[model samples]
Target chain A: MATDAPRRGAAIGWYVLLSALSLIVLFPVWMTIARALSDGSATLFARTPSVLPYSPIQWDAFSRAFTEGGLGRPLLVSGLVTLIIVAAQTATAVGAAYAFAFLEFPFKRIVMVLCAATLLLPIEVTLIANIQTLQEVGLVSPSQGFGEAIGALTLPFLAQAFGIFLIRQGFLGIPKDLRDAAQLDGYSDLGFLRRVAVPVTRPVIGSFVLIAFLSAYNQYVWPRFSVKTNRWDTVQLALRRFGLDNPDQLNLGFAAAIIAALPVLVLLLVFQKQLIRGLTAGAVK
Target chain B: MGKRRNVRQWALAYALLLPSLVVFAVFAYLPLYRLVHFSLYQQSSRLGGGERYVGFGAVWDVLSGERFLQGTWITIKFLIFTVPAGIALGVLLAMAAHRRLKGIKIFQTIFSSTVASSVAVSSVVFLTLVNEQIGLLRNVSWLSLKSPNSALFAAALSSVWQNLGLTFVIVLAALQTVPEELLEAAHLDGYGAVRRFFRVVVPLISPALFFLAIVLVVYGFQAYAQIELITGGGPLRSTETLLYRITKLQKNTDLQVGASMSLGLFGLTFLVALVQFRLLERRVTYGN
Candidate 1:
């Protein structure tokens, strides 16, 4: 039992070390929460940084963040834009992946190269010209309304090369016999795609969906320029403006930041498996 | 009949692929073409109000300019500061949590909790955390809020923290794939934990490390929200990355200059990707 005792002690040591590391990693988030819960008088004029919320915790920062900080509209707009982009990306990715996996066409090699090339040209590289293009098309102008700006925000992201590649890998995993049996049962190509391929590959699609939602929801650069006015700002943009505009009531800004991050944290909790799968898909063999 | 069926199948396939092809054409390919076209012209106003052909002059000017050089150098410095530190921390965290100890899953979750924070949220959190008046780290001498020189480091700190969750999750996944027998074999051979980690565990997980390195480099180049919210490329443009410079030029309606910088950034990224593959891929062991 001497060896057992040493092993158990080693494990306890590991626990202590890991717990300390986790606290350091999580300190910034904790500080934000504590500051958000404290009143302005408590946080602003304090000489020492408090690790926890001060007495008489104020809950009005969140309400003020939503109402006065103007995060409510942006939150709704971000949600709507995220939903549209997610749905469009899924549809486009599925169709393209299905074609690449199961069908043949002229210029197939060339088209595949074209699709892969887009992976190298990220949105940052094309931001300048895209803004001009969108402006010319009336999709991103001060004169345009919210609908056109939404088009601009969601258009460039309607399809993604990574999503296509990922879903194609999923489709390729379906056995040949499954495809032949579906055909023999008088299922058309589209019918097989809908009834068999999609159901079988739901896990991959789910992962892609979650990843796509996270990316779309957290987009900062595109929305920063595309949306012309505060009327159509996304949540990220609103948080920045609010934080910069309200230095005195920084607690409200912290609360808005928390509110902004709430959805993705909940998604992380619920879809932890899919997120890990999607994130590490291409990283490993 | 066979040829006709083939033609019909090909038509169906193309039909299915049309939406994606069209979107790519409009957004990706066309924008690249226009960026080149716009860069070659001199414009009198923001959106091409009055234009004159200026064959590569603006591009040459941007390439030779001090702003572009400084921005590129700062971006490279930012990459240097963040990438290795991020990978090292990720490896350390993964190693700590990769064991089969009881309740280890909770520790793993906490290690990756930062993944939920968006760049804006993380930047603001760090902003307040480092505020001079009331920040948690305000009194920390090295990261002093009074100095403008610490601006880039401050932004890099946030990026590293924000990326820790993703890096930890990916590395942990890689660590899990290390065969238990291999490590046990190494242990039985009288190798200490440190030696085994560097010799056995690292080589086995080198592919993931390499992948993480490339991704972090790309992320370093693409980082903007952190800089924008934290420093506003601030104090004296010390934190202005190439992408941030291009954004500033765009705001000033200098489309030609912005386009030139964008293409420059693209070429830089391409070169970096090539260099990384050349330097790092040789050591990556693919299979057991």
Candidate 2:
């Protein structure tokens, strides 16, 4: 690590410059938190509220955002959807990656190509068709409680190509001799996967989960077209609704945005490296 | 015995792979097939006009029309506004944080904090900042209602802010990999900090920079939520990018038009990716 050691005299200048940049970057978040806590939703727009919470920290707005603003349900929905997405993606990706890495099957090359090709046609490119498929499967207009929730939110993203690719690379990078040795030691294929492959590639799988979970949680477009009713609103859609419905309720809106961002903030704090690695995997060699 | 063992291996591999293959087939491959198939039809089933086969005419209709050309221009303008600004700021932040000074970790955390904010969250934050009547900036002397371009700039401002964290983290990571001895060698050669950076540091980090450029361009094309949220694709539809137009068509129930527009957007995305791979990828200096 080339830690660019600071010179004694010039350190002050670097500190000042870096501080200014930090303030600039963190300003929006500060503003958001301030408005969220400001009294009466009093800090509408014109006046810049203190970055620190202003007088009478609007505990009401937080409760209102949770209750009146129809936020809690979406939080639950987002949680459920994200949980399923992460679990399903990780499991399927592990299985497929293992198959690709160690097993011989007919159409193996074609299956590999198919996996790679999914990268090119991101859901944005196939929006209408996916919606149509969703409708055909009766997901778009489901009648009821759990089925509708699962159908619209979790079904579309049960698998991810990126996860498969990331974990496949993980499996392949393990030396062939190790797998052969495992087999010679009387480990079945599934046994080898459980005892060796998974534990060794846990970091790669961990990063993939982080990426997939974040993407699922942050989904905006799909929820818009899929969840026709507020009963199934994801956090992203509900936040947009708050903005649209109460653009003037600046405090409440920022409060909701802050609330929505909290989990991600905690996650990023804990797994910053994993998130970065997951995000930049495609860009790096 | 060999035949039976091979059969068993194939069955096990396929059984393990079935769930993922099925999901991809349904969600990824099936939709793509439909995208092409429905794009050929003359009219959407929604409109209740008797189906007339168009044989790609609908696609031609969407792409040839003025709507899509203007959309392309808006998307490109957004790219121009954000990409270079994002790169410049990213590099500056990366350099500033790369120092080994005391308490630098706090600065690095602040720089990367926006990565936690999703597109919708950031858009909401900016909507308040840029609101026309009660906006924080509304009373600023120069930026009144008459300022036509301010909203677009505001949208871009939010985008640039959100991008800061991603770019900073990536560039900073890349910067760490630049060999220290190389910088020392350049210093011994009497190259100033700026010259050393341009001659050696920049070349080494070009791969990271190139990656940012491609991702930013793709993001520019696909941008929607911010426009839809803050601007609603207007003060005058000025902020509507290519994806916005496609989404608008979808919303309005113009299925045929939306499908064609989707295809056009896909093509545009493909073309942009192809161009970057050809132009920038060739020049990228991957460090050993």
Candidate 3:
């Protein structure tokens, strides 16, 4: 009973700490939502916003943000590009991880070492020469449309060392006995991978999918440089223009910011369980 | 039969690996190889002609210049603020939520959400919050910090907030692995909260703390978005980091110098990472 009392007290203290952190995490989100609903009649920065839409909320801010900011085209572009990049990053990472975990080949150790060694180099350093290369390939020319622009934005992040490293760590957690048994039973490599390996590791795959999607969705600078046209801008580019153009319309900018972040937040909520497992899984190895 | 099976396995391995190899070759290795080549050549915009290979002159010019030196100093200053402050906040948050408290899962979710909010999003939110004219702090007179200084502080705040979730998750995971029996024994010995944490909890978690610190330092040097959004490296380039300066060189007036600067930044990042891994490896205790 004495031990139980201490545990209960400790639990209560933890509740207080959690409540305070929740407030800190939720304030910016609260401010964004409040500004979104307010129609510029409300004071956003004030301690007590009296004129905030108290009864019938304004939905017009959403439509105005969409139409005036030209966010639709960028949203579509970012979505499609994000989809493709995530698929590519996941496929490549999975394949490389399979090689690293299951196969023993000539120079296998060398390849793995090289992959680990390159993690420190940020992909930004290679942009200039790459832009020139894209221009040479005619992808950056004026004649090409949104398709080419999206490709240019997605091209650089297609294969990442970090992803390869992560998936390889997951792949290593699988027991080798299963692989050996499958091989002895006359199951081919691809068949065993499809039938056994992938099913067992679905949670890790889901986590990687979410992470890759988030990275692609939030990409800004690459799109800013490579797209070079407002017509082909992604969500981030559109919001940046909103901030720059209507510097006085803080409410509108805030509304647009909320809109841009909503999809990622929904995605996070859906995959929170898998994400936690995946992130902690890496540290375990 | 065994030899035949081994050959098939090797063939499958190579086939599975091809696409990743192709992508990395084009994106990472090819560009790295090309960056070295571009650093030597000069662009002639006036004549609309191709670059002439001018050898190591670009590298020499960049190293000898004062602007690059100033940019390096600023980047180091930014790192000084970001690395220690970011990791400490992460540890504090992690420790606070490490128990089975009510709504603990909800708190964890909120903390980790910032991991997905890119540097651009974080920077934009803070920029609006602290704007000189329309920011939240605009009307307060006791906020004696200058506008530019306030902007830098705001930038640091955004970075720390965004990093809080990542640091907390890592440290909390480490904290959870501490044996409960040992803590119970300490409590039986009449150890107070402060003494117990310092004497027992800290040493076991030191390795995670060390690892988090190294990552924060590397990321601090590579910061670009906050600098771009909040300060634009403005009010006399007070907030510019090395990566941001390299980007400005690439986007603004010059290209060749920018290429050289990028290579320089890459080298610096590489050196720092090496030093961190070497120094910090001594402190990290693997479960083995």
Candidate 4:
């Protein structure tokens, strides 16, 4: 709305400021990728090249990290774990949210309060007893076994209160008349859940899936508690191994770092809306 | 027939709740019940061998001891370093990108890019820069890893950056929800852009800011991966917050100690959450 001179100057100023801030935010990531692609180890003094990757980029870093640093194995484990968790949690949310939304059960109100209470009990607080239970049940091995590692990782997160709470919000929005109408059509409880209810809550289920997947994939602390070495490392745990390794593999660790972060970056870009929706669900009210 | 059907419906509902009930029972209630239960009993072995009943003494020791207080002070320092900056930057980013300037979507994506990176990914990225021997950013005041103070600062830097995306997205969404006409009205009333943002926009977005505070506080105390990755609780255990201390205790030494410390952390988190709910949550202004 203004004349050309000040407006153009203001726009240029904004661009400068925004780009500088963006560069600051993106700098670490950029540096990691830059390191991953370079020819040599970047010592603090003078060996470090200009900010971008050096010429003749080291593509072997990615492949080496994939094979040597054992990045591929953890990636597979993380994927499988994320898949199992997302499916299991979503199904559990459907059942629990269904009961809370529609069906009558004993101590329903008390159960609802307890479900809310679960939000307060973070995984860190419950680490000791949970690990004990896992050990006693032989789900985790002190010597580093996948049986225990997988069990310990997947079980604690099988049902999240946030997932149940989110689905219940969706279910509450379903009209009573719709359920009644389904009943008139001889839709049994399970039938309505399978058909109408599930379809109607697609957005909620989608958000739950993304959230659960991220939660399972991004686990760092639990993996340490579950497995001693890199044998059962999730990508997050594996990243630590790569971060601290000897000189040659150190470069691959940088590559592996980007590799570990790629899927999440893709997820954030693809499901930005759902991710935001899931994140802000608590914030809104 | 109706009575029989009602009973069947109740049975069906109960059956439906079984998986969630079992999961919650095993994961939530059992751990919760056992956190206190085990804290009361002293385990002789790291893997829970001998049991000596210690009652509330462990919890008391954990709360009143120097280690726990040291961790508490570090946790508070982390909060001070991260949360206000987190909220303020969130608001700033939202303000900058909330405007419909040229190519704003690109800037928006750039502003929110950190959301994609998790604690591990971000820590790895930060560690590459802050390593004492080889760090690109080692010379900086806070990112240096040799000293405990700067090492903890390095960990805090990662946490703050990692949280930026979530905070920015939440505040941006809150900004977008603020009606445009309100800002235009303020503009007509002679309020400058900065004044309008602080006076008009902030009150409306206080709910989002309040929510960010709660999440950041939770994130502050519960942060583990960054500390573990960046400094490994470092030079003098300076970077060790409560969660790091508890996990280290569990992994390295006795189960009872970790359990007791976990209980202390739980209590603190609850007290802080309750205080925030009581103190700051009321000032949050909801919209029409």
> Using Cα atoms with residue i matched to residue i, what is each candidate's TM-score against the true structure?
0.97, 0.93, 0.90, 0.95
Ranking of candidates on lDDT, top first: 1, 4, 2, 3
Cα lDDT of candidate 2 equals 0.79
TM-score of chain B of 3: 0.87
TM-score of chain B of 1: 0.95
**Tens digits of lDDT, candidate 3, A1-285:** 879998888778778777887788766666556655654433434454332342235567777777776678878988889988999989888888888887877778888777676676566667666776787787775566877887888887887777877777777777889888888988877777778877777778888888788778987667767886778878887777755444335456667777788788787788777766555554533
| Per-residue alpha-carbon lDDT of candidate 4 for residues B1-288, written as tens digits (9 for 90 to 100) | 988888998888778778877888888889888888777877765444467888886778877889888888888888898999899888888787787688988888888888878888888888667877666777787677888878888888888898889898999888888889999999999999889988998898898899999999998988998888888888888888888887767542366677788888888999999999889867878766
**How good is the docking of model 3, as DockQ?**
0.50
When sorted by DockQ, best at the front, the candidate numbers are: 1, 4, 2, 3
lDDT of 2 by residue, B1-288 (tens): 999989998999999889988888888888877777767765534545555677776678778988888888888888888899999999999999997878988898888888888888888887546656445665554333324465566777778888888898889888888889999999999999899999999999999899899888877776777778777777677777878887666532466677787888888888988998899877788767
Listed in order, the DockQ scores are: 0.75, 0.60, 0.50, 0.68
DockQ (0 to 1) for model 4: 0.68
Q: Relative to the unseen true structure, what is the C-alpha lDDT of residue B45 in candidate 4, on a scale of 0 to 100?
A: 51
Model number with the top lDDT: 1
| Candidate 2: chain B TM-score against the reference chain B | 0.91
Worst 10 residues of 2 chain B by lDDT: B139-148
- Model-by-model lDDT, in order? 0.87, 0.79, 0.72, 0.82
Fraction of native Cα contacts reproduced by each candidate? 0.71, 0.63, 0.44, 0.69
Residues B1-288, model 3: lDDT tens digits: 998878887887878777877777786777787778767777766645667777897677986687778788777777777778887777778877777666777887877777766677776666445555445554444321245454456667778876776787777887888989988999999999888898788778877777777778776876777777777776567677677777666532266788787788788788887887788777666555
Query: Is candidate 1 or 3 superior in DockQ?
Result: 1
* Residue A168 in model 3: lDDT: 76
> What are the runs in model 1 whose C-alpha is more than 4 Å off?
A54-56, A244-248, B46-49, B251-253
Instruction: Give the range of the ten consecutive residues with the poorest summed lDDT in model 1 chain A.
Output: A241-250
- Model 1 pairs whose backbones collide: none
TM-score, B chain alone, candidates in order: 0.95, 0.91, 0.87, 0.94
Question: Tens digits of per-residue lDDT for model 2 on A170-191?
Answer: 9999988999899899999899
